[model samples]
Target: MELTLTDDQQELRRGARRFLAAESSPDKVDAAMKTERGYDPATWQRICEELGWPALTIPEAYEGIGLGPRELYPLMEEMGRHVACAPFFSTVCLGVNALLCAGTEAQKQAHLPAIAAGERTATVAYTEPSGRWDASAIKATATRHGDGYVLRGHKRYVLDGHSADLLVVAARAPGSTGENGVSLFVVPATTAGVTRTWLPTMDQTRKQADVVLDGVRVPADAVMGEPGAGWAPLARTLALAVTALAAEQVGGAEACLELAVEYAKVRKQFGRPIGSFQAIKHKCADMLLLVESARSAALYASLLAAEAVEALGAGGPSAGASAAFAEAASSAKAYCSEAYFHCAGESIQIHGGIGFTWEHPAHLYFKRARSSQTLLGSPAYHRERVASLMDL
Candidate 1:
């Protein structure tokens, strides 16, 4: 049950597939992930400057294409298909959404142009060592200082944190907890008392880092939106991020299915193609169902996300609409996370010994599936969120 793509969307998908296929082949993906930085600078530069992807979601006023999630989701799918090693997920999905959802006009003007131009990179700092993705998980503190605020906390699992030029950090007011006192601040990566150490995560196709801000100071103007009221925007950003990531999972699952099908047709067993066997046929059929279902889930989530983002600019959605959107986002995340993981595992099983080898791309997909399943929130966690949102 795939969502029908318009002509322009189809064309964009084709172009992205061609570009990633040429620049981010399996060998390239392997080489890039082995790098300390997790991606090649030259390739990323072309992805930005030539494809104008960082500019895809930024508003036209900010020197961007002014497109939204609908357009960007397909591109994300292509990235996943190629296991492309880039910070497009961190910069475009989280950074651009953070600024758009929470930043003041002045703040947006000051930061977004560089991102749209692909001259700077940024990522959000929210999750801590606890590895929780909820607002209740935020334990960082920000205290009023001399004409600025002092932030203190440790952020872990920050996407592309080690090399990003800026960090949009979330910390609450001193002595406050939970959603009420939470605030978002934009701090330069080079700021005093800030440290970002590479994490060497399992999914090296995308890098992560440990960010420690001990007395990191930022001007009051660094706050994105009102200090105590940032949760709404942050929640919006997460929903969009989940939707975007689900699309990527769909792409990966699809690729795994394709790889399995291709291998099944070629590899011989019992003097005939393995695809001729009922077991292989069953595996391929199951994979096809999972891939298609995941694609549908991601597409549905993307549409809801587009509505939510547009609603943000139009004074936000009604409480009911917001709940519905959150429910859909969590539902998609949960289903796609498990579906992708299961599909990857099945693909590996279909390939047998070759799939288990580190040299094969099947294991890479399996690794990505497992890592991504737990990144934002595990399938169980998202299911709980969906239940809560639905008042069940």
Candidate 2:
């Protein structure tokens, strides 16, 4: 199949690039990162209203724009370029994916519409203090009551947890262990026993929180899908998240490459501009190559996700499609994480003293790159997954 963006996709990318460049200038980005919410709620609402970003990937039946993964990739890339601070990535990509994959009809009707309409923010609470991403590693317990469930657990590093209106929590059933007992619940953040504390980190633009569910009670209908069938959906959601994140990393890396190139051309060296030197030229070239390669991988994975959705509708259990998507997602995540990290570090090195100072934007991108590498899984973790998939 030919790998090219359609006219509509190109338009979406152009629009996103224009909007981010205008709205998230370096000074605005700095101000937003230091805010109490780590972002400007008013600005975020304006973006959602103007761009329809939160609903880009949702189905039309749910009041969304009804675009697919292919359309979303470039939009996400542009957002990453500016290091735009918003809950769109966590709420729309991760939270919506989990609900779409595993939610009951009632649950979907209740939550998806609000999310698609940009009226509510949501997140997936899976990672705990243990810091494991696998479903089998969850230790939070959910106990069955007369007509509801009681949740008692602590989830750390929850993206947008403090501001989210809804949470999709992963927990083990009282008697079950490992993947077999894990289940997903849709808990309102305003529930009686829910508490949230923001966590400080290197990346100031992206917010994370520690969420404590102290005997949080929810109706039985809150459970997503069958009691024991949560793992498959969780894994699928994670694969999609990996693809989206890889696209973001590629965007960030591309930005770093451009910044370095522009600085090199203007900054004078011993006798001439540093960009005229062979060493700086080669570094810029390598950064370009890495960004281009990672872009291809991200797009490939996104296309696979779209194809898998289609194939499942046609023949059911498209193992080949699923495997292809999963492998590609892992490959993209691993390669893009390392590539962005390298680009960030090299961009700083090229700027020398200024890059190390707080006044420069290079350090912001560097911190984002480092933090994003550990978001879903580290480069090393994804490499191991890739190896396992290849049976090497």
Candidate 3:
């Protein structure tokens, strides 16, 4: 089957490219990365308020654009291209997706509109110090306490956690293990006993934090969906987010290819542009192939995710369909992760010594590549996941 963007989608991509170039230029991105919040507040405001980015996937009733996952392709790719620093990933990808997947209608009414309005920022605090994204990695406890729940856990590697206005925390019952008793809670970031600490990371363009919930208490309404049945929604959320992330990886890989080719053409060696050399030529060709392959994988997976979302609205899908969607997600995640990292590393190699310097943009992309490879799940982990889904 042939897949091509509609004219509207193409326009959206062009518009996004223009906006990112103007707002997240190389110099501006460099400056933004050094900030405590990892982005300019005004720029973020423009993204949320002016561009209505946070509302792209929100339902129409919630004052949003009501677009599906496929619509997010352009914006995510643009963010990856510029490596723009913002809470969009945490707020839109993690937070919004978490709510959309698991949230009750009441919960959606309470939170999503604020996000759509750009008045709130949120993220999913799912990973722990164990550095795992699976339900088995969730060791936090949520105990009943007078019509509410008291949560105790320390979440590490929470994207944009330190600054988000809200957090959707995943934890299990006191005696539960793995997927059993898993539940999600929406807690205000300023709630008592909730402490957030920013952790320094290799990719400063993306901010992560350590969030400790020490006996944090929230009302019963904070519970998203049915208690002890959060695993399915969370899994879907991860699948969707990772597919979007794969799209971002494609854009980053493309950027690496362009950067390498640009340098190969301008940087002279042996009295000629190094791009003229067979070795450099081969590397650029390989990078191009990786980028193209990654883009195809990302787009196909994204369309599957869009179908999954539509399925959710129509009372969910059958077991077989869910498995198929999961398989595609794992495939895209695995291939895109490796492709981006490979392209980034090749770009750095093509730039030679200058690429390793702090002043050069090549190193930034390289670091992001390394960090993203292990974010949702390592490429190896996704491969295993795919195999399991295939029952191989």
Which regions of candidate 3 are displaced past 4 Å? none
Determine which window of 10 residues in candidate 3 has minimal summed lDDT.
Answer: 1-10
Q: How many angstroms is residue 267 displaced in model 3 relative to the true structure, after the best TM-score fit? A: 1.5
Q: Over 4 Å off in model 2, which ranges?
A: 312-316
Per-residue alpha-carbon lDDT of candidate 1 for residues 136-207, written as tens digits (9 for 90 to 100): 899999899989899999999999999999899999987776789999998889999999999977788888
> How do these models rank on lDDT, best leading?
3, 1, 2
TM-scores for candidates 1 onward, in order? 0.98, 0.97, 0.98
* Model 3 lDDT at residue 80: 91
Where does candidate 1 stray beyond 4 Å? none
Candidate 1 contains a number of clashing pairs equal to 0
Per-candidate RMSD, Å? 1.2, 1.3, 0.9
The TM-score measured for candidate 2 stands at 0.97
- Residue pairs with colliding backbones in model 1 are none
lDDT of 1: 0.90
Error of 3 at 295 (Å): 0.7
Q: Kindly provide the TM-score of model 3 when superposed on the true structure, using C-alpha atoms.
A: 0.98
What order do candidates take by TM-score, descending? 3, 1, 2
